[model samples]
Target: MENNIASTDNDQRVRGYCAYDWGKSAFETSVTTAIFPAWFAYLFMEANGISMKVLGSEWTADAMFSAAVMIGALFVAICAPSLGVIADRRMIKMWWLRVLTILGSVSCILLALSPYLGVSVGWIWAMIMFMAANVGLNGAGVFYNALLPHMGDESEMDAISNKAFASGYLGGGLLLLVHLLMVTFIVDESGSVQSWVIPFAMASSGIWWLGFAQMTFKMVPEPHIENEMEPMGLIASTKMALGEVKKTLMGIKEFRTLFIYMIAYFCFIDGINSVTALSGVFGIVVLGLTVSGLIATILIIQFVAAPAAIGFTKLAEKWGTKKALQFSLVCWCFVIVGALSFAPLELENHDEYDIQYTWDEGNNTYVATAREGVNNIAALPDDGEQQWALEYEDILPVAENEDYDGGYAVKWAYEKDGTPTQVAVSLNATSLAALEGTMDESRFSYSISGGEFANSTGLGVEHPTSLGDGKLDFIPKTARSLVWEPLGLSVFFQFLLLGVFGGALLGGSQGLARSMFGQMVPETRSAEFFGFFGFFGKVAALLGPLIYSLMTVWFDSRVGIFAISLLIVAGAIILRNVDVEDGIAVAKAEDERNRASA
Candidate 1:
């Protein structure tokens, strides 16, 4: 409302620009990208080894994660508007920001304790912590976003917003890389008790944010708006905020495009959020991949996504935001297709496979003795009822088997009820080594009961495009074959670029949304308009995740990719109609009239 952000002739006013987009980088790294989603899956998925049919039947991991997100966001929707109004009325926005920041940081730190609880109770505790962190993050963002209009006018908005987003990309990518290294190499052990990496990283992020926040608090003085004399209580203020929102919607005619854009953003964002959350679970639980595979894949995503976001930003600017968004959507479609082509399905005759293993007679444990070729059976002592011991350090029970095959059958198994139940399967020792690189430590021990042989087939896609046909591909491979290929070093640079683009576009849109509202709406009720922003953004968070979940549940991991593509497409389409100049003009006039009345 003031000329605090007025441009100078030099255009080098970087003093108060500290409030630029860098602050939100912590939110992206700590809350959105790193901790919550992975933790949720580690805590929640049904780990007792249910039937494959049942695993496919229940809510897909994606859907369940999204549903949790939606439930959490509902609280945000109900409170955001009221909080916005109160913040404005009190003219002490810093106080609210401090409170939210503390709440969010504490919750994130607490989530590290989730792994200690049993599966049933662990999931609930983690979800509650996640919800609290999400609410705090969202609440803080609403206020932070609102400050954009105070930092720059329409002319400088593109530059400031873009820079802030770029900064966020850099911050998020760097932190993720560090965390990945910590989890992969530094953490020498892992168990049900706790994971030192996640909580420590989250706490570190909180410390970083609180430290940086001081710069803005010191430099940016509060706006000089006259306080609303009416001293309404919290309940009364909430009712008033709702009334104002209704009035704003009905009274403002040209706001149709803005509202529509919000709806579109909600739809697409939810899908993106949900898919990201489910990826780890799909890899570990559904594909039966090792923990290392899961970590490596996520690291790939974090690094790859960074540059992809940046490149898309430039593309959006060149072809217009809509075209750029559509391009991202296209990429998403291809990824989905690729994922479906690699869908993991249980093989019939899976129990029958020829594999050779060597047993340590001294310890009664099995070791990877050798593998000859495809369909090779191993020699085992023909003791049918021998109770072979099966062990794998902790938790996930190892199966026992008195049988052996020359092919790559149960990579590691023991006997259960005098029968061999497949515990783990691999193609080769190299594959096992790659997987083992990510875990804390693992031991392989099996008892030799007798020799048994069986043949198994996998339902692999016939072609990349032919996902619907129920087909099987017989290949001499191991369980590691099911894991996605690790993207090479090139992906890291590409991710950096993408991160820049996405950060700029997303940050710019967020800032632009704030600017338009500020410039068009009545100044006396600026808080009211902001409430709408809070409502829309929070709703988008809820809806995006929910849709992603549903799609993954109905189809497979590929469905998540399709949903993400759809969201990018929709966001681009909606952004096309956003005009910042007109909205500002209207808001200025409204403020002028209000001053006259006063």
Candidate 2:
């Protein structure tokens, strides 16, 4: 961002504050939502097919991701208030922000090592680093958000906040664009993704975060406190925080409306947060979206969300923030139903499947890339133990056949049956056509004969969500038959459509959720009330992902999606009964009493 985020902006300090949002949002959009999910899926698929057996259960990538998100948010949610109290007491908000930023950015950079640590350990390493990085992100946010109130006077703070939000959107969007171009352009000769591209992108995002944050550290001075307490140790601070929480709990009857609103806020916010966090992984693992497609979806969300956020402000002005927020939450329910309705268009083209052989018309040749797992036959060495390997002879016709015109020749070179040293296969255009005609797909592509995920390998394979739905995948099934197939759109296009609609709802709901609460809270208790606001928001962040993860483990991913939708519906119902005017009156009365006593 420019030193002044805008030429019209006169305040250098405001630019500094906005700069921090610009820097850190790279982590939010690029590493968390865009790249890591697809990258981890690729690693996990190589290490453990579909799901890894752990604790007598299958752990899929999406579940692991949600668990990581839950753990990260849980840590921050529990400790953030105490940490905020400590920062305010010591007047060292900037100092703590700098430290946590390093922790997060460095952890992001460390993710690049996942590949080089060996294939077997790569996925696990990523999970560990991802958890650590998230801890830094959410933890640092404790102090980051604390600094916002100090950015400008009450009159200017809201506009300053809006500008920072815009900066984050633009910064994150640009970073995602860079990453998208890297993955799209950097490829092996055969057009497969190069291993180093993702690693380089990961490291670069970390650098972007830490590098641009220097401007903020310099320009945004530590907030001045009127009666700053001496910094205390962790135990002392925790005790003080607990005492404050007790007082808040004691005030329930006095601020009944606010507490009720908070509960509704918790349920709905958690659902929306989890959906945003896990959408990328779900697209990759279940829908089989390419790396390019997932990034594109996030990029679409990034740009679309900015304008939508502003548009919601207009809506709030017209309908009132409370009603506008309720409307947005209602739209969220529809979004969830729409998400469950996403089924891949039945694959018809030769180029659609993951491991496929397709004729290249431009080159007049056949091209193929093989997969490792197939019907227990295509297994490789594991833990120095020999395993069955799929032999080329099984796929190619016998050369001694009478009709064999010698247009195709196949040879497998190896030191051991379990490991192949080399494979050489050549076929002319006519011979390849003949082989394609003779080849039975069942022989080439296999299935897991028995298990929960007994998926057949082929172009027209249904999405995992559809498989989970079994005979009752009625919504998505009807959807594909009626809408997707009729329009002749690919799954990527369908994913984009979801992104556009969902992104708008997401942006509006999130932007309005806080603004509506702000309007109802008293100015005198801004710090205390907003602290609880942040607490509910952060704690709720973990809840949705945790529920999604658990439901995914117990049932299926689509079941997880269904479970979260119910949460939004619950929150919206609760929200309808909240009296916004009564809450505002209570807040005003409380502030007046405190001022008179002082």
Question: Which one wins on TM-score?
Answer: 2
- Model 2, 478-550: lDDT tens digits are 8888987898877788889889988787767875666556555665454456667777988777678779889
lDDT of each: 0.48, 0.69
Error of 1 at 297 (Å): 6.2
TM-score of each: 0.63, 0.73
lDDT of the structure predicted as candidate 1: 0.48
Alpha-carbon deviation at 343 in model 1, angstroms: 8.8
Lowest summed-lDDT stretch of 10 residues in model 2?
381-390
TM-score of 2: 0.73
Off by over 4 Å in 2: 1-14, 37-69, 87-90, 109-130, 149-162, 187-196, 218-224, 285-288, 347-472, 520-531, 549-557, 581-598
For the record, the alpha-carbon RMSD of candidate 2 to the native fold, in angstroms, is 9.0
**Candidate 2, after superposition: displacement of residue 448 in Å?**
21
lDDT for position 147 in model 2: 69
Q: How close is each model in CA RMSD to the real structure?
A: 10.5, 9.0
Tens-place lDDT digits, model 1, residues 1-598: 2444444411333343343234445656655555656566645544321111335564434455566666666776677766766665556566666677667667766766776777667767777776787777777666665555555554444345444455555565566667666655654333122356676676666655555566556665554456444768777877886776567668657565446555655655554444455554544433334454544554454444444445444554565444445455445444434333343332222222123333334544433322111211222222211112112212122322333322122233333222333322323445433433423221121112222211211221321111332212111022114432233212223223333333333434433334334444444554555566777766665555556567666755445555666775676566567554455666666667656665
